[model samples]
Target chain A: MSKPTAGIFGLTGCAGDQLVILNCEDELLDLVNLLDLRDFLMATSANDTRCSLDVAFVEGAVMSRRDEETLERIRQRSRFLVAIGACAVWGGVAAQESNGNHAALLEDVYGPLGRQYDAIPARALHELVKVDLNITGCPIEKSQILAAIANLLQGDPPLLPQYAVCAECRMRENNCLLIEKGSVCCGPLTAAGCEARCPALRIPCIGCRGPADDVNTASAWAMFEEKGYTRADVDRKLRTFAPKGGRA
Target chain B: MSTTIRIDHLARVEGHGGVTVEMEGGAVRGVQFDVFEGARLLEGLVKGRSYEDISPVLSSICAICSVAHSLTSLKATENAFGVEVSPQTEALRDLLSLGESIESHALHLFFLAIPDYLNYPSAVALAADNLPAVQLGLRLKKLGNTIQETVGGRAVHPVNAVLGGFGRVPGFDQLAELRAALAGAAADCETMLEIVAGLPAASFFRAGIAFGALVSPREYGYYAGEEVTMALDGESETIPAPEYKRFTNERAVPHSHAKHSTYNGRPYMVGSLARLVVNRARLGERGLAAMKRLGLRFPPDNPTDNNKAQAVELVNDVDRALRIVESLLEHGLKDEPPVPVAPRAGAGTGITEAPRGILIHSYVYDEAGRLTAADVITPTAINAASIEDHLRRAAENAAPGEEAALTRAFEMIVRAYDPCISCSVHVVRRGHDG
Candidate 1:
């Protein structure tokens, strides 16, 4: 059987998630051999953007018309399309101010020069096109990505935990940062699979993984309020990565 | 006859950008380095957010240089609030920056820039014939990540270093392990130096250029000092960091998303070459020795020599990291809490040498500690004009109608700087631009 071709792409966020794949020092060479890596622009200059692929892993949010067009093309070409970070899964931090006037923001930053480039408000991959799977994190965890690749190669669907990050924190025996330290944490609302990395180090979880399945955002906000966080703080924390809809 | 050379999607660089070189009748008409990545409005988003939230928010600017952004934001915030951290904390921050330098420089020199020299399309292709070199690059990168993960909690967007100090210090055992790794990596640095030296010399568009970098009186500046040293026209001057606005004179351009930066009305260079030129005397024994082995001299006029300068910095980073780890071991790692901050209305600037070059993050806060304004100038933006200048020169000198040669020349010049488009696109707000 011929090797399955795979492509990696970035749209409109920090190309950190793609860098995460490169960061897998131990498995990178072997992974390249296992699958026919086709298009990874950050790693190589020689790439075929037009080729069909068995799997396509894309990072970043669709923050412009060009990005949407790119994602649509990738979705059509690949049999399985995986959104590989919070940016692709939930628009990431770039979408935090989607409600604001993008033109004004651009003008504020670039003045008249901002009009030269066209951009739309940032949105997630699922909102624009079909996404077969999501590997969640601000920068997706390397182990989770490796596991997903393994599962896919074995002809099994990639499994991702739908539970809140709190479950993983408890399993790791990390103290409840919200209750114990009075720090505002979103572990109860964030997706699991990161092993509660931030909370383990005494830093509160900032919800870089986006919301968990059926999370009670209102209750989470109430809990933060009980911990002496202001309403603005709760709203800011929730909206930081994946803000609700607004047009550009 | 008019010929246009366009790279719609420039590869091997961070984020998204492209280049276009237009020539009319064999004379170069124009060269534009364009960043089409959608504006994230990072500066505008940070507005009204509390001071404490700025670092984490801005750290998203670039994953590879997250520590640089985090550290610089923290420094600016602390400076605004009149907070001072312990010397140990400062040393740890410096070590973290050095780790970033080692990893970033290794990745660029081996994976991105070396392929151009060997006439290969990519490092993966180069690896088939030369596995050891690729392995060595990976080893160095892994070591850098290990240091960042151990000290800052995670490799990308570190969560440990916060406010005025780290949330938790690495244990003695961890520091010793890192020290041991650094000591072992010395030979790898030598090998890297030899590899870079073996590559054919690049002499595309050599020009006398002004170089900018931070200057430290105490040591080689990475996470230290508030003064900048500028080398222009064979003369040097030291200016306060706050006076950067006076010299940088950042302005927006229509053809690109990133703002163009100029020093004294002309584009200047920054990054490894700039740092090395400005602070060559402060290089430790290993760093100086690596420079000698690489046959590099100060004030290199060719931008392509930045690759050699980065190789030298790899040695400096490892040597400095080893010294820092040993000192921490000797003093016994202290678990000190972050310095207390009293919120007040003020503005401050944080400048540091990111792996690519000097990165500046300046912010203004209201009395309630909410961010009122921000201006971030990335090294790539500072080098954008200089890259174009080189591209134009390369295009003008290329054999007429030799499109492939011109493209190769342009790519080499741009890649030599290792520009990070993600970091560079953060808009700078000059007076009333908002």
Candidate 2:
């Protein structure tokens, strides 16, 4: 019997999802004992650029050309690769304002007048390589990351519920944002698992849950529009944090 | 024969970034603590957006400090609109900033920097072995999150925490309960300070800085201040943060998205240690007493001292919050919501001491309230050159050519300054380019 090897990598993100893993606090020591930890830059002073591993947990969307290379390198070395956040699952902010003039936005942020650190527009690591799973959220949820890790360790596939936040809101018995608050929400089209935390706070859901599976965006937008939001307003809400072409 | 190490994606220091060290000839040839963590470039994109759109958009710059970002954007908007938050607005914002400090610092210490000193995979490991300290850290972190949620309405990319103070300020009773929690933690903070002081010193380059902090002339500076100066040599000019670019030179190199900054082309320091060094006298009886108990000095250059200094600040902040609550209770409530002023068309510079260090936002707005041009220089950028200088010195001081030794030394310097790459990027390069 051999210990499984694991490496964790982060890209264009706040590193929150990774922190969530670290937030496991005490559970990690016993948990890590089950596997041989390899190449976690945040934890240890000793790390290698390459490693043989059973699992590689990746955070952040592949944004830069260099990032594309890093993503490819991970895919090459690891047996299982899990995309850990919205950035990695989708292109994230690269796709955030994609509907807006991307070229103009790029110019504003990258050049024509901005600082020079030229990069190809952001795209998810999945676009370039195989991503076995996506633990999606703006920064992704900690509980999900923990669950996914447990599943991997158990040789069982993680059951990521493919439902909109609306379903979860119903489960919590909270009032619907659309019906009660007259707020525009992407909850109907966005993924669940945050337990509809944002709408619970009395604020509109900004679609940080990432796009729900096979979401009927057209129907959701039509419903939102019928609720009195104009096409432009509904369009903005759908595109807030969803990936490119993800919105209806 | 010197060995250099590069840390890609420094996890849990509040965003996308990394550092690279270059060793040469058995010495640190040059180091580029580079942050190539792909910039979303919030400031660059907000140019043509409407006044209302700025706060919500920039607030997502980094999910961890979203409230601080929201407040900064709103303050910039207020300046553009020439609207003042009533005193209540100021108070609420101050409280949120305090919240930001607690949350950000706790996260830094517990998740990001602590594992190095304590020898663990992460704070998660420390929770069981060192449950009390970890629990206290989580409690304080939660208090920050709780405050943000109460005021801003949610944590991580908050809204309703807009310009002109909050959409709805907390009532007197709510403020009291919050204060009570802060009060309950006073003894815990004292214990944490003592614990932090026990952490070993981080080896840092010993070049002293002419420390510049917010000397409010009223009280221990938290938010408002016009001009503050260090007791440097006579006749030294006190350059403001608006002039921060000139005082702390900002430049870019090929390896990173973040620009490196230096004070007069040399590294300086900011945040808790720097703040205490500059304003120890005004630290009231409690702060002074805590300082004495902690045994900190005025001319502290070592970055590792920050761990101790943070514990010191945790004490001061909780003390301050409790006092604020008591004062409000006694003084009675009043009707005010961020001061009101005409949206005067002009250029302005607004600087506040974010928990990390001085955060400066300078902008030019048209009469119609458009951010025609904007520049946001976070405290991390200010400390970039200084971090590099410290790394270089730390590496030289290390037994040369040893990557682990060099990394341990460099990591200590970075942890001490607590530079936020999510706010700014740094490129540590070894030697001049070939």
Candidate 3:
């Protein structure tokens, strides 16, 4: 059996997801050996940019004409496309620009200059094209990505955690910040697989991994409001990584 | 006849960008270090965000330099709120930055820059014949990450070091383990230094190019700095950090989402090379020893010697980390919560030497504790103009009308700077065409 050919790409965000993959120090060598890698621009100078692939793992939101063209090219060439990290799975921090005047914003950053390139409000990968699978995190967890890749190679469906971060906190026997300290923790609404990292460390979860499958937006808002957080505060926390109507 | 040389998708660097050079009648007309990544409008987006959320979002600008971004943002925010952190907190923050420097420098030298010197397309290709070297690189990189994860809560964007102090400090045992790890890696560090120092020197040099870096009155450092020292042709001047705009006269260019920055009407250099050139005398005992061992002297003429500078920095950072860990262990770890904050309307600027170069994060906060304005000047944006200057020189020196040779030369020069296009494009203020 031949190895599965793959291409990993990044568009506009922090490039954190890809770095998380590189952060897999112990498994990187073996993982690369398991796949026919191509088009990882951050790690390789020689890329088969136009090569067809069994899977394409795309990170970052599409916020420019070039990103759209790149994502379209990869989508057209791959059998399956996986959206990696919050940027691709849900509009990441870049999507926070959707409510602002993009022209005015661009002017503030680069000044009133005639640009050869075009800038648009950031949109998730699914907003632009079909995403066969999605791995969510502000920067995707190394364990989740490694598992996703291994399962795909074994011809098995990748099993991602469907429960909220609250479940992980519960299993870890961590005290609930929301209930105990009146904190604005988003554990009940955020997806698991981070091992409740922020909450376990005594900091509130900011919902960076996007909402979980069983998230009850209205109920979570009500719960936080009852605990003294304002509706605006709750919305801001929830929408930082995954804004309303951002998910495809 | 006219011709243009293009390396459309520069790989192995942090973001999406390319280089283009145009020539008419065998003379260089124009050259651009274009940034093709979409503008995220982070400055505009960050407005109205709470002070606490600002650092976490800004840190996402570049994964490799997350520590620098977060720490600088915290500094700016703390200044806005008039917050003062404890000495322990300050030490931990410095340790985190050093960890990032070690991680980023090792990754760039071994995985990116070394491949260019060894005539390989990428590190993976190099790994085929040099597996042990690659393994050593990974070991060192993991050591850096271990420190980060132990202190910052996670490897990439830090969640613990907040506005005033850490939400949760590491335990005594954790610090001891990290101390032991740094001690164990000393021999590997020397071996890594030898591998980089022995590489064939990349032959590109132009005398009298300007260099800029943050300056400290204390020891050789990145975290403690309030002013910048500009080195120009054997003469140097110090400018306060708040007066950075005077030196960084940024300009908007049509070819790039990222703007170009010039100092005193000419392109200047930053990052490890610039840091060492300006602060060479402050290269503490360990840095001095490493420079001696590697036969490296101050003010290297070759831009590619940035790789060697990074090798020396790796040794310096590791030695610093060992001392930091020992100091923390001596004082003992505190599970102290973050200091309380009382916000007021104000503006502040935080400048530090990121792994690449100087990174400045300035912000204005409303009385309500939300952001009103924000500005970030990344090292790559400052180096963009300098990179283009080098590219133009490389093109001028190349055989006329040979596209391949010109393209390679241009790519090598750009790679030497290790520009992070993703971090560079998020500038907040408008720029003028210089």
Candidate 4:
């Protein structure tokens, strides 16, 4: 059987997720052997931007008309379109102030020339087109991306962690950061698969991975409030990566 | 007759940008490098966020050099509040920046730029023939990531390097392992130097260009610097970092979303080449030996020599990082608490050299520590005008009908700078275009 062809792309956010794919040092050579890696522009000077693929993994949010058009074209060509990181899954950090005045914002950044490019509010891939799977994180975990690819190769849906990051913390026997240090951790609401990395390092989880299934947002908010955080603080933490109304 | 050459999507470089070369009557009419990536308005988003939230938010500017952003932001915030970090913390932060420098140079030289020379479409295709070089590149890159992951927590957008100090320091065993890794990679580092030096030299865009870089009084500076040294008109001048706006008269252009920056009203280069040109005397013994072996010299005129400069820097950074690790181990690791900061109303400027070039982050805070204003000048934005200048010259020299050759030349010049468009576009100032 022929190898499954894959194309990796970036949209609006930092190219962290795609960089994470390249960060797979031990597996990168094997990955190229396993798949017909077609269009990774960041890693190769040669690319077929219009090539068809069995799987397409896209990072970053749809923030411009060009981004929307590119996502649509890729969606039409690929059998499976996977949203690779927080950006594609939930609009990422670039969408944090999506409701702000874009024209004024552009003018502020680019002065009079800001009016040159056409831009719209950033949106997730699933909001504009179909997303077969989402491997979530500010920068997606290397192992999860590899796992997702393996599952796709087997003609099966990739298995994603459905529980909150707190579960993984408990399994790792890490002390509860919120309870022990009174730090406002988002572990109770954030998705697992980061191996509770931040909490292990004694830093509270800022929820870069987005919310997990059955996330008790109200309880999480109350927990923050009880810990002396204001409503605004709670809102800001939750909405930093995956803002409210991000879902399609 | 008139003809125009367009590269709709420039591949291999970070972020979205393109080039359009217009020729009329066999002379280059005009050239424009357009950055069509959506404006993220990072400066606007950073407003109202507290000093503590600044680094993490700004860290998202570019994943490739998140450490640079986060550290520079921390430095600015610390400056605002008058916080002093421990010597250990400073050493660790320097190591983190070195790690990023190594990773970025390897990725750019091996993965991005080398393919153009090998006549291959991508590094993966080139890898089939040059497996050892590719493997060595990855190994070197991994070492850098390991340093970051060990010190800052994760590889990208680190969580440990906070406002005052790290959230947690690495263990003795971890530092030992990293030291051993750097030691093991010395021979591979030499191999990389040879590989880059062996590539064909690019001489198209080498005339009448000035260079800018951050210079420290102490060592081959990446993290510690308060003054910038610029080589202009066959001489150099040192200016304080806070006065960068005077040198970097940033303004917008119609063709690109990213702002164009000029020093003393002239386009100047930055990054490894600029740093090497301005501070070649600071090269350590290992770095000096490598330069001697490769027959590389200072004040290089060609921008493509930036690749060779990065190879030289890779050796310097590894050697410097090794010495730092040894010093820490010699003095013994300490889990010193971060210096407490009391927020005050003041403006502070922090500057550091990202792997590409000098990066500056300046901020103003209200008495409550809420950010009222923010400005960032990335190396790429500063180099944009220089890139255009080079492209215009290269296009003018191109044969009348050779579109492919012109496109190749344009791409080579742009890639030499290793511009991160995402970081460059983060600059937003609230004022009318003057």
Candidate 5:
């Protein structure tokens, strides 16, 4: 069988997700044999605009009207779609300014005339098109990418941990920063995967990886206020990558 | 009839830039470069915002060179308010900037430019045969990241850097680790130089093509300097940053949304090559020795040789970084609290040597110290025309008649200057006095 073709596209976010993939230093090249990177804008100008896509990975918050159209096009062409990182999965930091309720925010940003606003309110891939799988993190991890690719090659749905950062912290033998320093950490709320990077460094989790499924937002919010955090601070912290309905 | 090949979407340099190579009757006719970053209109966004609100917003103007944006913003703000950060603050900022230099330069060298030379699709493919070399690149790249993390507290959009100085300072042990690792990274620079020196470097791309960059009297301008030009034009000439617009001309090209630039209707280069050409005297002993030993011409014309020049600069930067750190510590360090002045209102400009090229940021402020206007002249935009000129010359030299090799030749020319597009987006700040 020929190699599976993958197309990576970035919408409107820091190109960090793609950078992370490019940063896979040692194993970076071996992918050519396993996957034909048919359309990555950052890598090369050579692209197959009409090729059949085996898998497509999309990064960044779907913010602009043009991006919504592009994401739908990608979804239509791709057999399987993966939302890489928190931006695509949960809208990410830039979305905070856009308001989680995409509809209301559309009115707020573009005004009530947003009703006539030609561009649809920027929404997650699932809102506009099918998202077969989602990879959650501030920036998607290499290991998860590898694992997902492996599963896809075998014709299986990709499996990734859906737990909170708390799970990873306890497993890493690191102390809980929230308890020790009285620092407000989102470890109990954020999706697990980054291995408690911020907490380990004595900084509280700012939730680069959006909220976990089982996250108790109200409880976490209360806990933060238990510390010295103001309401706005807690709001900003939880809202880094909040989904449309999650912030409220 | 002349055929014009316009590159509406020039690849991998940074942000959005385009190029045009006009071949009239198979002869070079006209070339224009432009920056097509569509009116992001960010200059208007920072207008009423406080000094504290400006950092992250400006930083996002370009993901690849956010450090430049942050530093330039800090500098212009500092200049406007007459603020002075501690020597410790200055040292850390330099270190972060140095880290960005390493990361940005390595990306441009390996991922972008080197691919054109080796005929590889990307750096990932090149890394296969050169795994160890890639690893060394990663380690060197990571050293900068470590610096950003230590000082800024986050690798991307560092929150710790602010108006007066840093929101927080690194502990002693963190500084020690960076100092030690940087000392160790010096070997990587030597190794990098050895590798580039050993690689098969193609001949000069264009002879007598002058380039310009910022250079200081006391030091090579990392943060500040006059715009110095080098070519047959002679040694360095100081054109103030505010005056860069005089030399810079932009036009809309059909090939790309990115605009093309020319200095007085002639293509010129910038970045490492420009810096190397302009600041060769500032290299002191080692830089001068490396230049002589590299056997590079007094002014190398071939665009491909810029990589070697960058490698040489890595040597210079590492050496300088070590020396600067040692001197700072030896002098018992100076810490002036970040001068805190509310925005009184004025227009100011700031320039810094972004890894790929010269980054100029200017803004006008209202009486409230809000940003009123902004203009950005990123290296990529400035060099786009020069890249086209080099490409036309390179393709003409490599294989003149064949449009088949045009893409390869074009990418090569673009990479030679190591353009960064995302850095080109701009707007002026409004001064309060206005």
Candidate 6:
């Protein structure tokens, strides 16, 4: 049997998710051996853009026409397309509430010349294409990325934790920063795979992993408001990293 | 015959960028290092957002150097609010920055550029033959990530570090662990320098370009510098960070998403090359020894030598990191809460030497602490014109009809700079006075 063909592509974000794949310093050599890696521009100069891929890990949001074209080409050639990180699954930080004046924003950076780039409002991968799996994180956590790859390699659909970050925070025996400290934490609304990284350090969750499954949106909002945060503040925190539908 | 040599989708570098060199009648007419990455108007995105949210978003500009962006953003915000952090905070931030520089340089020299020098398609191919080299690179890279994870919370986008100080400072044990790691890696760092010195010279050298980097009146440092020093053909000028616009005259250009920058009407260089050129005198004992052993001359004209410069800096970074760790451990750890911030209407600029080069973050906040205006100048943007100049010379020197060789040469030239296209295209407009 031939090894599974894999290609990791980045679109229009920090390239952090892809860097996470590289940060798998120990597993990287083994990963390349297990997968018939073809296209990973960030990692290699020898890339085959036309090669059919068994698994395509795509990061970054579709923030431009060029990105859309790149995604379409990759999607066309790949059997399993996994959206990695908050940027590809959700709109990430680039998709913040500043879309109303995106035109003005572009102009502000490039003067009138920004019009030539023909940039679109940042949108997640699923918004434009069919995503088979979604691994969410600001930069996808190392364990989660490795696990997803291992599962996919075995022809098993990767199982993502559907629990909220608060559950993991509880598991870590960390005090609830939201309730105890009255910080503007988003643990109740966030997906659990990061081991509650920020809150573990007494910092509030910025919700980089998008939304949790079966989360009570109404109660989450009420809890935040009860902790002295206004509805606007809660909404702002939610929109910071939550996917499009995850926002209130 | 005139031909346009386009290496679209430049590989083995961070983000999306390509090189387009136009050859006309054997003379290189022009060259454009096009950044195909999408315009992430991060400055615009953070317009009405609170000050705290700005760095988190902007830091995502480049994952490889996220710590640099985060620290610079925090400094800019801190400067704006007139916040003064404790020495511990300053020391820890410096340690984190050095960690990033070491990691970035290691990644570039081994995984990225070494493949080119060794004539391999990628590190994966190189690893098939040279496993130990690849393993050493991984160890060095992991060391970087560990420091970042320990200090900033996560390796990529840090969460614990905020405006005034860290949300949770690493304990004495954590600092000691870093020191032990540095001590263990001392021999490895020397081995790294040897590996760097072994590579065949890239031979892409020229003079007349300006070199710029953040300079400290104190020690050779990144975060310690409030002023920038630019040297061209032996003459140098030190400009305050607030007047960065004078040096980084950024403007938009056709055929590239990122803008081009200039100093004194000439393309200027930054990054490890510029850092070494500007601060060679202030190098620590280890760095000076490494330079002497490596036989590196001052004000190297070759961009490819940047990799070697990075290797030398890697040793220095480790040396500096160990000292910082020792200082922290000696002083004992303090669990200080983030300093209280009261935002007022004012504008401030934070400048630091990111791994790739100088990174600047400037912002204006209203009385409510909401950002009113912003401007960011990444090192890649600053090096854009300088990159083109090198590409033009490389193309001019290339044998006609050897498109493959020319393309390879151009790619090597660009990659040597380790241009982070993701970071460069964030913002260009510099005159955003609040």
Q: Which stretches of candidate 6 lie over 4 Å from their true place?
A: B253-258, B426-434
What would the per-residue lDDT of candidate 1 be over residues A129-159, giving only the tens digit for each residue? 9888988788999999999999999889888
lDDT of candidate 3 over B1-434, digit per residue (tens): 88977777788899877887888876888887877667787777788888889998888888888989999999989888889888888889888888888889888888888998898988899999999999999999999898899889888897887888997888898899999999999998988988987887676545557889998566566776778888877888898877888778776655544466777788788888888887778776778888888776556666766777888888888988898899888878787777888889999889999989999998999999999999899998898888888887777777766777667777788899988878886432111121
Order candidates by lDDT, high to low: 6, 1, 4, 3, 2, 5
Write down the TM-score for model 2: 0.82
lDDT-best of 4 and 6:
6
Q: Cα deviation of A181 in candidate 5 (Å)? A: 14
**Per-residue lDDT of candidate 4, residues B136-213 (tens digit):** 999999988988898889899988899788888888999999999989989999889888878876767557778999
Quote the positional error of residue B164 for candidate 2 in Å: 2.8
- The Cα error of candidate 1 at residue B218, in Å, is 2.3
Extract clashing residue pairs from model 3. none
Please give the range of 10 consecutive residues that has the lowest summed lDDT in model 4 chain B. Answer: B425-434
Q: Which regions of candidate 1 are displaced past 4 Å?
A: A214-222, A230-232, A245-248, B253-258, B426-434
Q: Tens-digit lDDT track for model 3 on A1-248?
A: 99888999998888999999998999999989999998788998888878899999999999877778888999999999999999898888888765657777776666665243467788899888889999999899999999999899989999999889999999999898999999999899899999999988898999999988876778877888899889878878888888743346
Q: Rate the local accuracy (lDDT) of all candidates.
A: 0.85, 0.66, 0.84, 0.84, 0.65, 0.85
Kindly list the interface RMSD, in angstroms, of each predicted candidate in the order they appear. Answer: 4.6, 4.9, 3.7, 4.3, 8.0, 4.7
As a TM-score, model 5 comes out at 0.77
Q: Pairs clashing in candidate 1?
A: none
- In every candidate, what fraction of the native interface contacts is reproduced? 0.72, 0.23, 0.82, 0.72, 0.14, 0.87
Global CA lDDT computed for model 5: 0.65
DockQ of 3: 0.63
